[model samples]
Target: MIRTRTQAFRLTLGTLSFFGATAFAQDSHLPEIQVRGPRDATIGTADSASEGAAERESFQSRPKLRPGDIVEAVPGVVATQHSGDGKANQYFLRGFNLDHGTDFAVSVDGMPVNMPTHGHGQGYADLNFLIPELVSGVRYRKGPYFAEGGDFSLAGSASLDYFSALPAPFVDITYGSNNFRRALAAGSRTVGDQTWLGAIEIEGNDGPWDVPENLKKANAVLRYSQGSPNRGFSITGMAYKSRWTSTDQVPERLIASGQLPRFGSLNPTDGGNTQRLSLSGKWFDKGPEGETTISAYAIDYQFDLFSDFTYFLNNPVNGDQFEQTDRRRVFGAQAARTMPTKFGALDGVLSFGAQWRGDRIGEVGLYNTENRERLSTVRNDKVQQDLYSVYGQQLVYFSDRLRGYAGLRGDMLRYDVQGREPVYGALNSGRGHDAIVSPKAGLAFTLTPQHELYLNAGTGFHSNDVRGATISTDPASGLPADRVPALVKGRGAEVGWRFQPNEDLTATVALWQLKLDSELVYVGDAGSTEPGRASSRRGVEATLRWKLDRAWRLELDGALSRARFRGLAPEGEGNYVDNAVERVFAAGVTYIDGPWTASLRLRYLGPRALDTQNTVRSRSTMLLNFGGRYAVNKHLTLGLDVFNIAGKKGNDIEYYYASCTGGEVVSGACNGGVNDRHVHPMEPRSARLSARWTF
Candidate 1:
């Protein structure tokens, strides 16, 4: 370890002396030597083999239909959408259906993206505002074995880093099927000691639904920075707004009987609008003393959504349409430091960090509605929630081939709620608090120059909705309701191995298990949280990357898992966890030669249980996407991307539930309503063409 200034100086002097002597003996001219460090290495420098980083160039040619697909670059992860494009994407990993990012954490440029206690859902992480072109790389970890991971990181976490400066300014424009259009402009310039970066994006699309989904969106980003990553400061501002019409899932019975089209909407008026504005800044420095980083952010957000999943089931006359709204401001800050350590001839590092966040919600409400008009208010409330966390971790090299890590973390959460409505607010107004402590440990052994093994275990937690943690009575039924704890705990363990036979091939495999004390289940129709049973999951994952030749590269990833409820249920209920993903596989090939770049990707999602009984299940899906780019000249490039290349028919999502489709009454569908599989069909094959110009 470079523990002191004197040691660092001595090492520097030794290297300079050797190079000077070599130059003097060889010739009059000196030979240049470039220094590189292991800033993003997991095979030998990490505690777990499952943690790694993806460079921007690795996925630059990937064909993406939605911005959230950026997360798919992480091995064994899937991102899909069931509603409009503007909404957050549904995520699945480690046998868990991470509803809107509930168990998986996401961040961009040191700012959290997962919103706690959102109107639509808890941990609602909308990535539509992301501009893929501006991202430089992604760092990811799994199994909750890291002290840096906080809320919603039980299964995994991903962090996206942006480029400080671009090689050149560029403008990109694209047009595709179904009236899709997009334009983007981005660049960076240095002014004296500081650099300024700016980007803007505008997009619109009409999908292939019976009712056109007129989606419109806009996004902008501005940033200022100085210095380098080891020593730097930056401030950034972002703005995003979007509106879209949604086509929710339709009943299989209705579609089979010709009563509804596959992509038809029961309520054409269903839609939503949302906006977000934020400012964030960070500073960091690394020297002989240590490494330190500090960051802070403030955000203002607004959302409004209208949906009707069970049409005519609750109110036959009004069609069961309803609205959910959320308006709030969020503030947060975090700081961390790492220092070199020596314990009796052993080299090591000690790290610690602190985090604080608060959310002030002006109003969060649900309403009964018809079309787009609100008929009556259901419940409205104001809430303030605050969270604080601190953690310490240490890594020590026990021998030349063995290393060990240990960490401890503590977190506290507090919330206050006030009912804004007269009748409903009076029944549910209250306050609550909760706290938890977690510990983590890991061991790594280097078996050979090309092989390494790891073992890790840790505990993590996610916060429940403020309303759920403080409710005294049910807003809809006026019945006594039990309040849930502010935070729920999770435990995880993994054994992994990494192999690097040469510079051209790398492989990794892991076996992992996770258990949750309680799951957070959000009821969209009622805008409420319902308690879910404790669950356990175990899975196997593997990834491989091979450079076949200079121009050809191949990548493959696969995962299989089993998930089950922990305790016995009702007589008819089974132990299976609903919507738990069972198997996933992905493969891709890239060809880069001269001025031509092309890529092809294949993804497959296996069947999954849709009900606890293990009876109702969702169908499998397979898709292929292709992309190719040709450089017209040094200043211009043309690209073509084809999604769903084989035109395979599939469903983005599926659910088994009871819903009334109006015709159910005449058709005597199950007496009360129709109990069937509801599905949101995947988008059809589409082609997009783009032109990029550099100046």
Candidate 2:
């Protein structure tokens, strides 16, 4: 294993090169256009739904997907729903803290779109702005296993892929749920054997929060590609524009009042607009040196926001209150080549990437003069990193019943970061670089053509700096905020079995572990700094499938996780009192018969932070969905989805940052119990319905 330390100015320079005047038209694809994840894409596997439970899974079913009503179908996943009243609209993942890096990573085709202030946990994309009809596929992956584009990597990665699969051009329009409505159009064509694909989506909805979060959005994509079966190249561009009425978060006190916001009113926290743009490309060539492929990408995110409760009334007598806006961007590149060798096949991948971000931060006041202020704080930070890796896997045919292989990759990377902002204390950027020589190895033993056993081990890392992308200060305290630590270093191990008892049945089970240097807490006072302590995630996952002779199929999946922080310190904010959960269980079942399909899912959340004491609580949720696809003549299939048949409410624990002061104040209006002490509430229930026609 050879670990590398050289920085990649190469990725940056290459990203710019991709935008030149060069354009290649895509050739018509015959059957299917495959869209996949970083790791799985190169491995030649795209059957994620058919993969036994032991492997990583995406949040959504496929790539190039757009979905609104679909979020409710997955186990252990939920969006803060409206009770048909168009109220609070927000979503949480894994009960971890909800913002930016602490939550799930959302991207489009492997390019990140999350706003710049990542460390403080501010999510860049709001799901409500997406139009369901424009989607091709949405995928969410758990754990830190696969190959990803860049930073905020602790929570895994979720990706969105749009498509050009139909005949000519088409338009779609729909209205349903929460007074929700959407309009979208997408298609592709051929010019001189060159394929050209393009799509545009727009959507808006009134959220169900008390002070409802209203949202609107527009997104567009254009692509060009050309090649015969042996060689091909593609170029693409995407842009997104979104606006929302802020739903100011409630103080723990008001939440205790059992009061929700009123409809058609200003949400008190944040509202306004956010936008993003991205460009990417890929080249594939069949060569004498096996198969060669190259890819590159870049993205930028910006947000303009306002607070719900104005501190300044734009009056001449007083300045504006605490309103703020930020602009952030991240860019990088990757290149790899795969060739067949005598020892199976050898794959060499070199990933070179960098990130640059600037926060044009200023405070504007509203209702109160004491709070009104427009302080422009400029922050510029950049990171240059490069990775060198070599992995090989060989399929061994041990007799006729046994097969599988040994796989491994050696990796090395370095990160350098520095910049200055008006907020004094956060690091003025540091050489945040460390070289880790990590190794990966795996093997599978075949018992019979119908049965097999597999074992695998790999290592991964979170950033080293405790402070992440966004450097936030408590508006009241004027001190830095809390969130997931800068880097979480760890490795994982897994052992599992796959069996095919009969032509109609397949089953799989595995045990795995993930150990970390610093634990992640998402509770009353989230992000405790526990230096050198290693937290661990241990569990078992399993899946079962039955393909009855023909026309009938059934699939079931389940997972149980035990996650915890060890040797945590209370004084220094150790892992012990953090808000994240200690254990969890998830299960899903799907059945397809004829042109109709039905599914049911259940998630069991074990003990988790209920208060600052880290008091643990328990909750379980169930969901049922039914869908039918009738071929109204061969070319068109009618589809429908139903969710939350049980209507159960589940809570994902939440928290904030606090200076224990033995209990003393760090800065301004932030003080004492309620405001500083974190308080989290359960989201309500809501429903959505949709239909699609494909030609």
Candidate 3:
């Protein structure tokens, strides 16, 4: 094992020296192009920012253990997994936990990735189908100030664009600790006037747990495209499938008492399986005065998850294991038009867009199970949910130094739920509809050629689960339950500034706040909607990037925030938002010279309150990772990645809740109050080595 940073650095240098002679002999010089303004000005609006074309190069040189980690490229976003790898990762950004993409929208190649009203969570986004090497660029926005962003985009949004063609064909194989193995093959070819690209990936891993994760996954993508984004058409198909055993969170008291190890689980049979198949198409046209874009997609998806959070708290006989299943087909389409326009003495642009989506779910249900055997059903339902939206925006340039933007959007949601089986003879079958209108405005002032100031305010919302919107009875108790509205509203505002002091340095700072009407969620475990109180969050973020030289770059990003429920609580009880992370920091350094490249990154997640009351808190965690690569010849290259290089002892996730075990009884009953901190510890230090052959 590599023990220290110095040793790792020296090792990397030594390896580069061994291959330097051969690498330099085959090196060729390339011409350079320089532009005068901000590198991202062309791709970003006043309220947004783009990662730029260099982002693809950065991704190629970095090391990531999972495909979802690519989101970390977005400043102030953090990704972590608690359960099986097959499930969507937990995301944190801008003072929101963003549980499984709840408040963050994600898309790839004009296709939406977040699933609404999912069995496990709302807005579940799984990126396991993505092939990282195929990504061409990433564009991100921090607030809901853009007219194009809709549901689940209150906090932020990210769009990933894939390359239509590859520079060359390549095959890569990787091996790592903990029985990790991966193989990938990708290439592109020109057929007449169209470009065709194909890629496939297969991977497996047995993580460091008493019960092996045994994760198996595969992904494939095929695409055909002609022309460019300004005028182009493309059709793509994607398929992904995965299965894994999970080590769910264990009580800290159990580990403290030597009853369970930090990496052990009370229920060893917990796991899940998931699959997604999709077909999508995109077309764009650029005319003398305007442009138009159209996109359409269809997807079939299924998920089955078995989790035992409280071993015997709810059901002593069955051990509290439960299953959540979702099977659905989704269809969606979007169209947009942009054109230059002027009013009186102002010069500007006008844009209009529309989106339509529908989800037909065959069965979304929850069940009681023991050792993966179903015992009793809680609620089984068929749901049909549809959403339609139309929006328009106008950008007016008052002068060379100032500009203004205004937008209006309206959305309508319809929900239908049919109960397949009732719990306790109580059935819930109903239909509901809701409509909302949101407005957005922004102002941008150019203080200098390289400095800009922006003020933005916007309104956004997330759709409630169809089952929650229509359910009239609680499946757990068979009691009358209040049905929630079909949609929840959110409003946000931000004041930010961007500065580019020189060609090598760029910095940005923003102060923002957001308020939510209510935190309503579909409790998949209970098969009902749980209404929460109104809440507010305020935060400040700062980001900096410096290219110290032609071969080295450094980046730093940090955010701090406070989150709370608005209503006053009873005396002695706090109103803190549970699990709302307050601080995050990330720093990285990258070096690239000739055929050698290296990167080192540090990430920190600060302590947070685990419940409404601040008595219980979590510990902060910090990690370091390193990656290095060397080109051996024109057709061959080698790479190494070290994760958690310091072997930090920390938890990937933590929660405060009640749980019971067979051996432990409290008050002559197997019920433990809400005092246990269930935790999933982080993985220990591990490494992966890879070889790639290019043709």
Could you tell which candidate, 1 or 3, scores higher by lDDT?
1
**Candidate 3 lDDT trough over 10 residues, lowest sum:** 22-31
Q: What C-alpha lDDT does candidate 2 achieve relative to the native structure?
A: 0.42
Candidate order (lDDT): 1, 3, 2
In candidate 2, what are the lDDT values of residues 1-695, reduced to their tens digit? Answer: 11111111222122212211011112223214422211221011111111211111223321111243344233333444221211113333343433324334555443444433333224334443343433444444444333332333344445544443345466555555455666667777766647787788877776555555567778888877776545777777878887766444333333444443322222344455667676787665654444444556666655454442322222223322234444545455444444433323322222222222223222111112222234443333443333333333332333232233343333444444444443543444444333443444445454454566766665656543322423355433466655334444667667777676554676767677777676433322221122334666666666565655455555555655555566645573434434444444445544455555444444454555543345433344344434434445443444443444455444333343332221112233324332332232333344444444544
- Least accurate 10 contiguous residues by lDDT in model 1: 22-31
Candidate with best TM-score: 1
Backbone clashes, each candidate:
0, 64, 0
| Residue 397, candidate 3: C-alpha displacement in angstroms | 0.5
Which model is ahead, 1 or 2, in terms of TM-score?
Answer: 1
Q: Write the per-residue lDDT of candidate 1 for residues 169-200, one digit (tens) a residue.
A: 89999999889999999988876657788999
Model 2: per-residue Cα lDDT at residue 63: 15
Candidate 3 residue lDDT tens string, 371-471: 99999988788889899989988877676666678999899998888887755323688888999999998887767767778888999898767677777
